[model samples]
Target: MAFLELHDIHKSYFLGKEEFPVLNGIDLDFELGEFVSILGESGGGKSTLMNIIGGLDRNFDGEVDVNGQPLDHKKEKQLDDYRRGTIGYIYQSYNLITHLNIVDNVLVSLNMTDLSKSARKQRAIELLQKVGLGDQLKKHPNQLSGGQKQRVAIARALASDPEIVIADEPTGALDSKNTAEVLELLEGIAADGKLVITVTHSQNVANHGTRIVQLTDGKIGEDTRLKEAYPTNDHQPEFKPKILSAGASYRNAFQHLSYNFWRNSLIMLGTAIGLFAVLLFSGVGNGVNAFIQDQINSMINPNSITVLKNPTGKNLSTTELQQSLSQYSSNPSKLLLSDHQINTLKKVKNVDKVEAGYQFSAFTVSYNGKNNSGQSLQTWTKAYASDTIKTGHAPKNNEIVIDKSQAIALSSQKKYKSLLGKTVKLSFAWVDKNNNPVQVTGNLKIVGFANGGQAGAITATNYSTMRNLLNNANGATQANFASVNVKNADKVKSVSKDIRNTKENNKYVFGAITVGDILDTVNQYVSIASIVLASIAGISLIVSALMIIVSMYMSVSERTKEIGILRALGERKKDIRRLFTAESILIGLFSAVLALVLAYAGSLALNHVLYGIVKFNMVQITWGNVVFTFVMAIVISFLAALLPARRASRLNPIDALSAD
Candidate 1:
C-alpha cells in the first residue's frame, strides 16, 4: 500500500449542458522519500490535478486514500483536516500575505499548530534560517527577489511538517540563474524523507526530481524514473494541527490594522467624532442635573416642604395656588392661615416643625439714603437653608437678612458686610381686618446676607417681628402660609404626600411642595432636552456605521487573495467569518478609545469655561458612559461585519488564488 493514492480520478466542468473534461481515469501512487514531477503544458490538467491532491478541489470522481483509509471528500471538515495534517502546498505565485513580514507570513501556518507562542516564533525563525533568508525575516515579500520569494513560499509549505509537499510550477516565474537556485532548493526538499511533488511544463525541471509522469490530455502518458528515492527519516509529529484560536485571529486582525494604520485612522477618527458627541452630551446631561439640584438645594433646605392653603379646594398641586394667594395681599383676610390649620399640620406624622410664615410680596428697604425694593420679602423660617447666609447669620430678633445683590445695591460687595450692623427702614403693604390696605414700617438691622442661589431672594425677617409691626400698625397679622419641615431628608416625600392628602370635608385643604416637586418639574424638561440633543448627535453614529460597512466590503475585495491563502491553509468558514469580524471589532475598539479621549478633553474644556461663569462643573462623564461607548462600538462593529465576512468565507478558494 502507498502512503498516498489517487484511484480512478475523473473531473469535468459544465457550461450549462456542455461537458469539458479536465482529468480522465488518473491513477497514481505516492510514497515518502520520493520527488515526482507531473509534466504538462498549459490547460493540460496539471494545476487541476494538483488542486485535487491538495484538497482544494474535491468535485471529482476519485478515491484518495491516506495510509489505507479512503478520504470523504463530500465532508468539508474531513477534507480540511486532511489538508491541515497531511498536505502542504507551495504555489507558483509565491502567495505571501502582503501586510505581513516574512516571519509573520510563515507564522500564519504555525498559528494553526499546537505550539506555544515562544516555540512558534523560534520554529518560524529556524525555518527562515534553514531557507537561507534568516536576515530578511523582518522584510516584506515585495522587498525580496523572485528566488528568495520562492524560498519563503517553500519555508511556509514545510511549516506544518506535513507528510506530502506539493509545489506547482515552482520555478515557472524565475530566470535561468534564479531557476537553478530554486530547482536546487526543490531537490534538497526532496532529499528530506517526504513525498515532494512538483508540477511543471519544463522537461529540465522534471529531470531534477526522482521520477517524471508525462500528462497528455489529462491522462498519464508515460512514467519515467530518473533516480532512486531518498532514505526514509520519518518520525512522530512534533507539532499537532489545530483550529485557529480567537486570540490569534484578533492578533492577526490587529496586525493588518496596524499595517494600514494611516488609511484606517480616517475611519476611526470619523467614528470617534460620533461617539465623542454622544458621550459628551450624556456627560452634560449628568452635570446639568447635578448643577440644578445643587442650586435648588443650596437655596432651600433639601428636606423642607412649602405648604400653602388649598385655595381652589382642588386635589391638584402647584396649580397657580401660590400666585392666587398672592393676589389677596390687599384682602389679607382670605390668604391668612388659621391657627387651627397650623396646629393640625404640627400634629402630622414626622413633622418636626410647622412654622406659620408671612410673605407679603411687595417690600421696600431704605438704607444709607438709598432705597431697594422687590417681591422677595418673606418671614424667615427653617425652610430657608441657613447656609445661604453668605455674610452673616439667619435673621433673629428685629433683624433683616437680604439678598447679596440687594445688599450690594445698598453698598459695594467689598463693604456690604458693613451693612450687617446698620439699621434699615423696612416698609411693606398690609391690610386691616376690614380689608383696607395700609402701609407698615419698622426699623430693623441688617444682620446677614443670603446668597440667593438659582432662585433669587431680596429680604427676609422673622415672623414675630413682622407680626409686631403689623399689630402696631393696626393691621391684619395672621400667617399667610406655612413651612412644614422634616428632620430626616429621606421622609420628605412621604411627609409631603401626607400633607397633600390632608383633607377638609372630603377636599384636600392643603397644597404641598418640596424639593422633589421642583426637581421633577425641572428634570422632566432637562431629560427631554438631553434626549433630543443626544439623538441629534447619534445621526453621525449611523453614518459612521455605514462607513464601516462600506470599508469592510472594500476590505473583502482587497483581501480576496489573502482569503484564499487562509482557506488553502485549512481555515474553516467560521474562522474566516471570525477574522473579518475581529478586525472590525478592533477598529471599533480603537475608535472607542479615541472617542473617550476626545470626550474627556471636550468635557474639560467645557467645564473650564462653565465653571468660571457658574462656579460649578457642567460636564461630567461617568464610568457607565465609558463602558457604554465600548460596548456599543463592539456590538455595532460585529453587526456590520456579518454580511462582508460571510461573503469572504464563501469565496471559492481556487478562483480567489487566481484573482488579480
Candidate 2:
C-alpha cells in the first residue's frame, strides 16, 4: 500500500450560486522514501491543494487515504490526528514562532505527546543537529540567517516523527546558495526513507525531487519520474525531532506570548480593573445590605411594626379626616413623633412594646463654654421614648444618657473634668410661633453615652420628660405617631397590616412597615448608589476591550507571514485560532489578578477612613469577590479575543505571505 493516496479530489466554491471549481479529478499516490515536487503557475490552486492535504481545509469531495485508512468526513478527529502525527510541513518563509527559541519551535509539535521533558530536549537536539542547526537551538528565529531559518523549519517538521514532509515553496524566499542548501536538505530527508514533497515553481528545486508533478487550472497535467533529479548519498539516517510533553504546549504559548507583553500589559490592567470593580461593588453591596439588615434586626424589636405619619407623596386633599389635621400641617414642626401616641398604639393586637421617636434639625450645643457660631457645629437631634442608650445602661427616673459627643463637649469646657461619669447640661428653650420662649429643665444624672463620638451629643430622658418639654411650650399633646412592637417576629407584619385595615376610614394611616421591611428599604438605597458607581467603573472596562481588540488585530497583521508559514507547516486553522486566543486570555488573566489586588488595597484604605467617619466597620472584602473578579477577567478576555481569533483562522496563506 502507498504511504499516502489522493483519489479524484474535487473542490469548488459558490459565488452567488455560480460554481467556481478550484480542483478537479486530481489523483496521486506516493510511497515511503520518495521525493516529489509540484510545480504550477500562480492562481492554479497549488496552495489550496496543499491546505486540503494538510487538513487546514476540509471543504472538498475526495478520498484521501494514508496508511490504508480512508479520510472520512464524519471523522474529523481522525483527520486532525493524522495531520498532527503523520505529516510535517515546511513553509517558504520559514514559519518559526518569533518569541520562542529554535528548540521551543521544534518542541511545539510534541504538544500532545507523552514524552518527558529531558527526553524531548534530547530529541530536539538530535533533530537540530541533523538539520545543521544544533548551535542555533537557543537562538530566536529573527536572529538566524535565511538558510539557517529554513534549516530550523526543517527541524521543526521532523519534531513529530512524521513519515512525510511537505514543503510549500521551500526556497521561494532564499538566494541561490540558500536555495541549494534547503533543496539539498530535502533530498537528504527523502533519502532517509521519508516521503518528501515540495510545491515550487523553480526548476532547481523541482530537479531535486525524485518525481515532478505539473498542475494547471486546478487539475494534474503531468506526473513524471525525474530521472535527472539530484543524487544524494544513500547512507544518511532519518532525523527525529523532539515531541513536546502534555503540558509543554501551554509553556510554549506563554513563551511565544511573552515577546508582546508590553503591548498587552495595559489591556490586562484595564480588564483587571473592570473585573475588580464588578466583584468589589457586588461584594460591598451584599455586605452593606447584610449589615443594614443586621443593624435593624438589633435596634428594632424583633416584633416592631412602624406606622409612618405621612405618605411618601402628598395626598392631603384625599380625606376629610386629614382636614381635621390641617392645623398641625400648617405650622408643623419636625419634632412631631409623640410618646403618648405610642402608648395609644400599644393597644393594638398582639402589641408587646411601643415607642415613639422624632428627628429634628441638628441644633448647636454649647461646647468649651461656647456654642458654635453658625450651623457648622450642628448635629442631628434624635429623641427616642426609651431604651436607645448605646453603652452603659438606660436611664432610670430622673436620669439622662448623653452621647459621647456631648461628654466631649462638656469636658472641653473644663467645667466637667472627665467623660465616664461627668454630667453635661444641654439647655434648649421651647418657643411658639409668637416667639415666646418657655423655660424647661429636667435636671438629671448622666447614666450612659451614645457611641458616635463628637458627632451626636444626644441627651436621652424618659418619654414624659420630652413630652412635657414639648407640650408645655409648644402646646401639642400628640405629635408624629407611634410604633407597636409585637410579641413574635413573624406577627409584626401581620399586626401592621391589621392596624392599617382596622377601619375603612383608617386608610389615612399613611403607610405601614415591619422592621425587616425598613431594613430592606435602607439597603436598597445603598445598593443603588454602589451600582451607579460601579457602572461608572464599568465604562472604563469597555475601553479595555476595545484596546484588546486593537492589540490583537495588530498582532494578526504583524504575524501574517508567520501565520502563512504555520499553515504550510501542518498547523490547522483551529491551531492558529487557539494561538491567538491564548495570548488574549493570558492578558485578561493578568489584568484580573492585578485589579483584585488594587481593589483589595483600595478597600483597606477606604475601610480605615470610613470606619472613623461612620463609626462602624461595614467594609468587608470577601473570597467571593476575588473569585468573581478572576472569572470576569477570563470571560472578558474570551469576548475580546473572539473576533481577532476568527480573523486569524480565516486568513489566506497566499495573501498572508504577500502582506508587508
Candidate 3:
C-alpha cells in the first residue's frame, strides 16, 4: 500500500452564488522516504491541495487514504489524530507561538502525550539540536532571527515524531543561504524514513527533492524523479521524541500562559477588575444581611412579639390583642381593645407572659441645673415590663427606676455610688385637660445603664407608675397599648394567626407577635437596596462584557494567520474553536476573582460603618457566591467568544495564509 494516496480529489467553494472550483480531480501518491516538491504560481491551488492533504479541509470529494485507512467525512477527531500523530508540518511564515519559548513551542506537540515532563523536555532539546537550534531554549519566537525562527518551527514540526512532513514554502521567507540550509534539513528529514512533501516555486528548493511535480490550473502538469534520490547513511540515527502526556498538558497549560503572560497581561487586568466588582457587591450585600439578622436577634426579647398600629386603619385594636391574651376574648363586635383587652390577651395560645408598653418621648433630656442637654433617649413606659435590668430590680407600684444618665441628672453627679440608691428629687410638669400645668414629683434611682450613649442613655420606666403619673399630670390614659409574649417564640406567628382568626373587625385590636416578620421586613429592604445598587453597577459590567465580546472578535481577526497555521498543522475546526473559547474562559475567570475580592473588601467596610447606626452586624460572604460568580462569568465569556470562535474555525486556510 502507498504510504499516502489521493485519488480524483475535487474541491470547490461558493463565491457570490457561484461555484468556484479550486482543485479538480487530482490524483497523487507518495511512498516512505520520498521527497517531493510541487511547484506552482499564485492562484494555482498548490496551497489548497496541501490544505486538503493535511486534513485542514475535509470539504473536498475524494479518497484520501494513509496506510490503507480511509478518511471519514464527519470524523473531525480522527483527522485531528492523523494530523497530530502522522504528520509534521512546516509553514513559510515560521508559525511559532509568541507566548512560549523556543523549546516550549516545539514541546507543545508532545504536550498531550503520556511522557513525563523531564522526558518531554529532553526530547524537545534533542529536536531543537537536530534542527540546529541547541542554544536557544529560552528564546521567544519574537526574539529570534527569521532563519533562526524557521529552524525552531522545523524542530517543532518534528517534535511529535510524525511519519510524514509537509512543508508549504518552507524556504520562502529565507535568504539563499538559509533556503539551502532549510532544503538540506528537509532532505535529511526524508532520509530518516519519513515522506517529505514541500510546495514551493523555487527551482533550487525543488532540485533538492527526490521528485518534483509541477502544477497548473489546479492539475499536475509534470512529475519527474531525480537520478540520485537516496544518500546512504553509515549509521542509524537516535530515537526522536514521542507524543505529549496528560500530565504534561496540565503543566504546559500553566507554562504556556505564563510564558505569554506579558503579551496578554492587559486582558488579565481587565478580568481582575470585573471579578472584583462582582465579589464586592455580593459580599457587601451578604454582610449587610448578616449584620441586620444579628441586630434583630439581640435587640428583641426571645418571647416578645412587637406590636404596631396599622397606618391604614383597617382593623380595630381590641380583636387581635384579645386573642393574643388567650383569654377567649374572640368578639369582633368589641373590636377596640381597652384595658380589658390587655387582661384577656394574657391567656391566648402560646401565651407565656404579657407586657403592655408604649413610647412617650424621644427628645433630649434636660436637668433643672445642668451644662449640656441630655442625650436624646427614647422614653418608654409599659403597663407591664419584662426588660432585663443590669443593675437594680424592677420598681414597685409607684416607685421609678431611672437609667444611669437620668440618675446623674437628678443628682448633679455621674459616679455610680452617688447615682445609685440616691433619693434624687425629680420634678417635671405636664399639661392637664384644660391646658394647665400639673406639677409632679418623683424619686429617681439609677437602676443601671443598658448601653452608653454620647447623648444620653435610652430610659425605661414602670408602665403602671408612668401611667398613673401621666394620667394625673396630663389627665389622659398614659398606657395606650400592650405587649404580649408567647410560650414558644417559634410558634408566635401561628398563635397570632389563630388569635386573629377568632375575630373579624377586631383584627386591628391585636398586633401580630412575630420576630420573623420584623426580620423579614429588614431583609426585604436590603434586597430592594441590593437590587438597585446591582443594577447601577451592572450597567458598567454589561458594558465591560460587550467590550469583551468586541475584544474577542478582534482577536479572532488578528489571529487568522495563526489559526490557519494550526489548521495546516493538523488542528481540527473544533480544536480551533476550543482554543478560542479557552482563552475567553480564562478572561472571565480573572474577572470573577477580581469581583469577589472587591466584594469581600466592600463587605468588611460596610459592616464596620453600618454597625454603628443599626447596632447590628451586616453582611456575610458565602462560598456559594464565589463559585456562582466564577461559573457565571466563565459561561458568559465563553458564550461571548462562541460566534468568533466558530467564525475562525470555518475560515479557509488557504485564504487566511494568503492574507498579508
* Top candidate by lDDT: 1
lDDT of 1 by residue, 354-420 (tens): 8998887778899989998877788888887768788888788899888888888898868877887
So what's the TM-score on candidate 3? 0.77
Give TM per candidate.
Answer: 0.90, 0.71, 0.77
Off by over 4 Å in 1: 231-234, 309-338, 360-371, 412-415, 421-443, 468-480, 509-511
Q: How does residue 657 of candidate 2 score in lDDT?
A: 59
lDDT of 1 at 561: 95
lDDT (tens digit, per residue) of candidate 2 on 196-265: 8888887777878889899999999999897533333344324333222323434645765677777667
Ranking of all predicted structures according to TM-score, beginning with the best and ending with the worst: 1, 3, 2
Stretches of model 2 off by over 4 angstroms after superposition: 5-28, 38-82, 112-125, 169-188, 200-209, 212-253, 270-393, 403-412, 417-457, 464-519, 568-574, 604-620, 657-660
**Largest TM-score belongs to which candidate?**
1
TM-score: which is higher, 2 or 3?
3
lDDT agreement of model 1 with the native: 0.88
lDDT of 3 by residue, 528-624 (tens): 8776776676666666667667876787787787777666555667767777777777767766766676677777787789778766556567898
Q: Rate the local accuracy (lDDT) of all candidates.
A: 0.88, 0.68, 0.67
